[model samples]
Target: MKISLKTIIAGGALAAIAALAIAAPAADNWENHCAKCHGADGKGQTKAGKKLNVKDYTDAKVQSEFSDADIVKATTSGISDKAGKEKMKAYKDELSEAEIKEMAGYIRKFKK
Candidate 1:
């Protein structure tokens, strides 16, 4: 069997494209699930965000305080204040574990 150089290059290119397609994170979930409260820029400036005191994802100081796992946990399990007031709702029902992790990564991109 003989494989031509063009065939090898095309195969390599296709492999690279496939890898990128699989590695690329899905962000539409973030926009649909979080943008309402987190804001498109993740500034937590929306009306409900203000009411709930949503964390400002764009703040470097705030970003450094929480690890990615913490974000994932909070997103999956939801959050409440010291007074037991609901700060955020649990997404475990609507999002898969992988999706929650990806959303954490999306949140990280807001660090500034």
Candidate 2:
């Protein structure tokens, strides 16, 4: 069957919109649900993050201390547990493994 120009254009447009729609919501979710505590820039600005002196992902020394695995675990379980405390809320139930990774990668940006 031949693909019509109209069909091709519509399909391409749909794909483009779909891609943006999907990617945007995830980033927004990460920002709204997690950013406040983690800092919009991902430096751990949550009230607890501040009181407990949360790890600064932007710090070269701090970022270097943990591997990618460590970041994902930290996001999923909570920063306090990884660091040995109760300063953070465990997100194991709240967020998926992929989301946790996204948050980690978001924070990793600060390392530079």
Counting clashing residue pairs in each candidate, in order, gives: 0, 1
Q: Number of the top candidate by lDDT?
A: 1
> What are the clashing pairs of model 1?
none
**Model 1 lDDT tens row, 1-112:** 5999999999999999997654445477777788899888999899988887788998999999999999899989999889998888999888878878888888889988
Writing each residue's lDDT as its tens digit, candidate 2 over 51-101 gives: 766677778999889898887776677655455767667777767676777
Stretches of candidate 1 exceeding 4 Å from the true structure: 1-25
* TM-score of each candidate structure, all chains considered together: 0.74, 0.62
Query: What is the lDDT, from 0 to 100, of the residue 55 in candidate 1?
Result: 82
